[model samples]
Target: MDTAAADGTAAGNTTGGRPGRGRGRITSIEVLCAVLLLALLGQSWLRSTLDVPALRTGATVFVAVCVQALPFLVLGVLISGAIAAFVPARVLRKVLPRKENAAVGVAGIAGVALPGCECASVPVARRLIGQGVAPAAALTFLLAAPAVNPVVMVATAVAFPGEPGMVAARFAGSLATAMTMGWLWARWGKLDWIAERALRRLPEVEPGSRWRAFTETARADLVEAGGFLVLGALISAALGVLVPAEVFGVLGEQIVLGVLVMAVLAVVLALCSEADAFVAASLTAVPLLPKLVFLVVGPAVDVKLFALQAGTFGRSFALRFAPVTFAVAVVCAVLAGLVFLGGAR
Candidate 1:
């Protein structure tokens, strides 16, 4: 009787333990299946709800921005991963100038080789910083890569046909903004303002495991940066739809107001640098200087960039850097315009 009772007790314990282990836990796959079922059930209602013009417009802009930026973002992360996995810090230091200031200049010039938009540059810059590159030089490349790249230049030229001066002015203005900011950060910026995570160094990759390190780093950065990118796109689309059209009508005759307004709009719109020139060109009422300001400011600082910067570096760094960048970009654009566009065309 005693042996039989012990066996039954053990059998009961085993049976009870299995259900207890999974009592309240839900797997991701189960949650996903439930969500899909709900979505299918609400398909008609969801379609009707999103059918409004404003929502439709916002949706289009959001999709356009995401579609345009995602490829470049992917490219940036892949390069970043390669840097982490393969490139030695010593080699990067050797290739760049010894002095931070000179390295900033080199970085600015190097920007011309990357033909991607602003989204592509951020991850690359962050990776450079993580890999022991000077912050000033990496920051310069961050600002310049999207602005001075050949694709952007060609787009600018096509947008403003026969206006070689606009193209020249844009290049000069953007380069000036990048280098100036780099120098300023070198002089006054604090490393502590950057997030600890951003500055954290990865463990050295074993030679045989380099590819594994590369893929893992790329995947991690993509997942983190991609969320901020989507958030920026959503904010930009909402602002784009909400801003009144009358604002453009009022600015044509007022050069001072136009420049300031256009600069603000550049920040708020968060247009891709490669595509911003066309949008600026389409604003027929605005003068050339204002359009130039828009083009320069959009790439250097914008809502999208601010979000990415805040996420990657930290809120403190973005707050300080973005406002200063905006001011510098505006001043540079105006000066470049005076020199190249012959005082606002």
Candidate 2:
């Protein structure tokens, strides 16, 4: 039995209506969500007619990016569901590295085996920590797994096609970001402040019916994950429209500002690492360095991630930890630009 099922949370009919017994009642939350989405779409259209080019542009980009990202989110949710249904917690804990530095090292490498986007990674991360994984190691896995995973690495390679250097930069940058943050956190970052919820016991998913477990886990994940994913998408979309087209150009040369801005965007948009490359591609004005910052930072921490982290760990820890990670990440990314992207030795 899954932990949730063992707890009886996953036993009843979640939808409450049989699949074929005529039809089912709609829940208030679902109805409200649909209404809100429709209203947002309508507002988007209404704003278009105003002839405000910036508004129209931003909305269009936002919507397009969100659409582009939906597939990734769906894929993430499905994969996460699969993990819940198939993999037992005790086994997963065993798959991790037993040593300290090795744990972080495995975190960088494990990105390949446990393949998925950031959204999917969140639950996995929580599960890892809950299984008595070391905090620094868990943090390393959380940061690196999404960024260095095959899905993202392949995309980065494609993004800078024929320019293998960019590919190398992407990989190195991501690794540096993960390891640096892990090391820094191990060295000075706050661990005691993490929330207690993130460490909650792993729900032992009962194999009542494979399909039922899948759906139940999927729904629970969606409910917990979907809303936060939406918030990230909305913020990213809003930025696509609201930020001035020329702003990136001006900020790009100001390396510090560029990195900070991208870091800020990372927090605000909370984009899935898998999809962030494409978003990075869209920031025409921002120099590659800043855009690189986006890819490096997105998977590590953001507003939605903060919420999840705070929920999972503790608010005080997240507040202290996220900022520290952010600062370290920015500095590391900058140095990456210097070493890899720059001609500096």
Candidate 3:
């Protein structure tokens, strides 16, 4: 074909061809418009159908959870950003003990300073290992950073309201779980289990740009964590209404069964550590001890944390660590709950 004719044909195709592909690439605004249109069309039907007491209660609970938790989530992500972008890794190196066992204890306690979620901790832990910190120490920080942080503690307190013991139990259980795992790793963990990639050092962000880095980091984390928190609220609300009340009463009596069930639920939910408190609090069916287990275990060894650990530390590390962590967290949580919350009632 002549150059002019070919150019004309290309222009036409660019303007009008591949209609199906264009339609398939739907934008968020387009989806919103479609949803609005459907809502308008089904307005009468929805009004009649959704007027049931159950649906109203569920919706109210869902909204309440999201509203109550979102501000805390924002606060957590902001603190996480400050830790990631403002704090220098050199500060950790100087602060941690030279002796491996002592370092593990220090690292576990240092978790109080970093308010990031489990997902944020994985990369930081891997970087710590790469930067010549002991693997056990880094792992301790990894486990502790999410569960024992101030933002998460605040959220737990808010979620449980007057139940000050729940806050204490969760804090003690999660810290104990992290420290125990660290000690176990120091004694028996093999270096070969870690992937080499996890040992490579990451580039440090420039100190001067920390403010910009902080805001950007906070915004990104908030967007990702917020979506998961909203989803968790929806699921908790739905389960609140759908699950039979008798089920809770029966489970409440079976302490062991309730503990195991909540642990399993923690793994399945894979909730953000900052928001899991509200979800756990919403489950009034189980005893306080089980709910305590759920809060403690969810942040330490959920499916999300397992996957992140596998990707960063290697499959071998995750397989061994997750199960052990799960067992330890359950035991610690049950004991702490008994001590703080008082005898599974």
Candidate 4:
């Protein structure tokens, strides 16, 4: 009787434990199904809530921004992943000039090859620094890659079709911003400001596993950057609803105010580089200089970029870097606009 009782208890324990564990945890698919079910049930209420003009407009803007920016974002991640997997740091180091200042220029020019947004450039720059590249040059590339890349240039041209000069000014302004920041860093920047982890060398990817490395890198970047893009779009949509049209019209009448406001908006909007030109162009009331400022400043320094920099390089570095970059980018854009767009057209 004792042996039978013990055997039955053992069986009961095993069965009960397995069933309890399975029932206690929820899988992702189940959660997704639950969400879908709730959404379906709430569909009418959701529709009615979003039926207002302001909310509808905001939704449209949010969707538009996401739809326009995502392709470029994807492209950027793919290129970044390729660079990470296939282009070794030694190759970049060999290509760049030995002198930090000269390397800064080269890095800025080299950015043309990387047709991605700021989201894509940060990791590459971090990788460059980690792999023995001069911090100045890597930083220059960080500023240049998203701004002066062909993808961004083409988008700008398309956005401002008759204004070829806008494209030229944008390219020049962005390049200038990048090189200026690089030189500034070379002159006064400290290595200690950057997080130690950002500087640590990454292990080389095995040649046999390069494809796997590329896919993984691309996936990680896409997931991280995509989140920031969505957040920026949401903020932009909210601002569009909150800020009155009269405010833009009033600011546009004052050149200095317009420029400053546009700069602030660029920082706040955090639009993807490839799509920012269209958004800037859409502000019919804003003058060319302010729009130019928007284009230049968005790529160089924005809320999203600052967050990314802080995460990648450390808060200390971002605190020092973002404001300086913003100022420099604004100055460079103004100068380039005066020269190329003939004093803001």
Q: For candidate 4, lDDT tens digit of each residue in 76-100?
A: 7787788878887678778999999
Tell me the lDDT of model 2 at 109. 71
Please give the CA lDDT of all the candidate structures: 0.82, 0.69, 0.89, 0.87
Error of 3 at 211 (Å): 4.7
Kindly indicate the candidate among 1 and 2 with the higher TM-score.
2
Cα error, candidate 1, residue 273 (Å): 1.4
For 99-181, candidate 1 gives per-residue lDDT tens digits of 99899998898788644457657866777788788999989989998899776787788778989999999999999999999
Please provide, for model 2 over 1-345, each residue's C-alpha lDDT reduced to its tens digit, 9 standing for 90 to 100.
Answer: 588775565344545444555565677898999999987879967656776876677667666656665566566556656766776656656866777677777776776666655555666777777878877777776777677776677666654556555556667777788787777666776546666777667776667776777677667756654565566556655666677667756676677787788878777777666567656665666777777777777777787778777766777877787887787777666677677776221
Candidate 3, 116-177: lDDT as tens digits: 88878887788788888899999999999999999899999998999999999999999999
For each candidate, how many residue pairs have backbone atoms clashing (under 3 Å)? 0, 18, 0, 0
TM-score (all chains, Cα) for each model? 0.67, 0.73, 0.91, 0.83
Off by over 4 Å in 4: 1-50
Compared with the true structure, model 3 gives a TM-score of 0.91
**Model 1: which ten-residue window has the lowest total lDDT?**
113-122
- For model 3, the superposed segments whose C-alpha errors exceed 4 Å read 1-24, 207-212
Worst 10 residues of 3 by lDDT: 15-24
Candidate 1: misplaced stretches above 4 Å?
Answer: 1-92, 203-249
User: What is every candidate's alpha-carbon RMSD to the true fold?
Assistant: 5.9, 8.4, 2.8, 3.9
- Which residue pairs overlap in candidate 3's backbone? none
Residue 146 displacement (Å), model 4: 1.6
